[model samples]
Target: TIFLDEIGELTNSAQVKLLRILETKEFFRVGGTTPLISDFRLIAATNRDLKESVLNGKFRADLYFRIAGTSIYIPPLRERPKDIPVLAYKFMMELAQSKGVSFGGFSDDALSLMMAYHWPGNVRELKNFVEKALLLSEGRVIRARDISSYFEEHSEFGRSLPTKFDSSVPSQLIFDNLQKIWEELKAIKMKLSEIETEKKLSSGSETLNIEETEKKLITSALEKTKGNKVQAAKFLGFSTKTLYRKMKKYGLR
Candidate 1:
């Protein structure tokens, strides 16, 4: 079986080559003149809409039709909230067993946050986050604080923005915001590259100072929720106890 992920990212030349192979069931090596025939099942996956790509001339219509013999649409994580806890626990248990650690599973608040999160990165991201949480967790139960810190450290905008369509916001505004976010993400990537280079050149023992970042995130959440710790905790995916501890530690009281 041959599986191609992100098939939509293929160039026109590559697409034409692939289409030829699919149609003829034969392929020639770069330097070889003879064609090689093979019988194999091909499965392709792409996040982009292939129909839109075909209409936009980014993808070949023949190639799209040939490859899309069967289509399966798996909804994003936010769209299927019910599956979050099940997958989260599965990942948590697998990680724990692999690491040879005993875990009591996630706290109620932690589970709530996992369900509430928009999960822009989807199942893979959730699995990674759970693994990281399992590793970082000091107690038997994975707390909301552990996962919240992971989100803060990795999230592009310091929080998971809703991936669902909102009727309240204008379409233009949403597009503008997405554009701005893309630019900011590019800048952030460049900055991170520079920092990584500096770290490699230096001791390599240095790590990101997440204290200030966490403080800023907490403050922002608090401000947005109007000093309501409970609301702030939910927004930041932190337990109320963890939020209070952070507030005290940061002298935000």
Candidate 2:
């Protein structure tokens, strides 16, 4: 099996090349080509929207279709609120044990706070933050004090309230999210501009099919959710049907 950690990172040209390989059982090295053949399963992961990339010509369309013979979208931590406490306690216990330190657990208040806050960085971030609590617990009980530093420094999870240096959680997340989206929109717009200059394809006149639109959303949602749509939609605040309409419009179901 070929585990592609971030297939989205492959350039549009590379994606096109990958498509050719998948369809014809043929491939060539970076420079050498004897019409090589290989047998392997492909698994790719990404936190970027491949479909938007495709629309903007940053990713290849045919390649996405081929790779998506079956797709499993993973949900980010923020969407699975119920799982938060469970994960936190489990990680804390395991983390404590791994450190050879005996611990009871986190205080209820701390646990709720952890659960309430959104983990933008996901499991990797959660695991790292828990480690700090393990290192500085006072009474075998991890408290907010042990982990608040994480939220403050990251600026995604809400910082402590009303403090001189604390950040507003909602505002920070919004600002961060908008900044990324604006940047991506700008990049895609630039690409669109270039495409128009090249092919005279006008955005106002672009007649994109529903399937095509869906594909773009799937790719975009995947990127936003770090390959998770459930969270991405929550981030986008769209209803299921609305999102479905987009997918259908893009031909991405």
Tell me the TM-score of each prediction against the true structure: 0.59, 0.52
Score each candidate by Cα lDDT.
0.71, 0.62
Superposition error at 40 for model 2 (Å): 1.7
Query: How does residue 93 of candidate 2 score in lDDT?
Result: 45
The local lDDT score (0 to 100) that residue 199 gets in candidate 1 is 50
Q: Lowest-scoring 10 consecutive residues by lDDT in candidate 2?
A: 205-214
Best by lDDT: 1
Give per-residue CA lDDT, model 2, range 1-253, as digits (tens): 8898878899767777778777888877769958888988889998778779878887777788888778788777766555565566556645654565534356655766776677777787788877777676632456677677766677744433221222545767756764664454344334333433433244443322323323443566557568565775554345666666766666554
Which ranges of candidate 2 are over 4 A from the true structure? Answer: 26-36, 93-103, 156-253
- The per-prediction CA RMSD against the true structure, in angstroms, equals 17.5, 21.9
- How many pairs collide in each candidate, listed in order? 0, 16
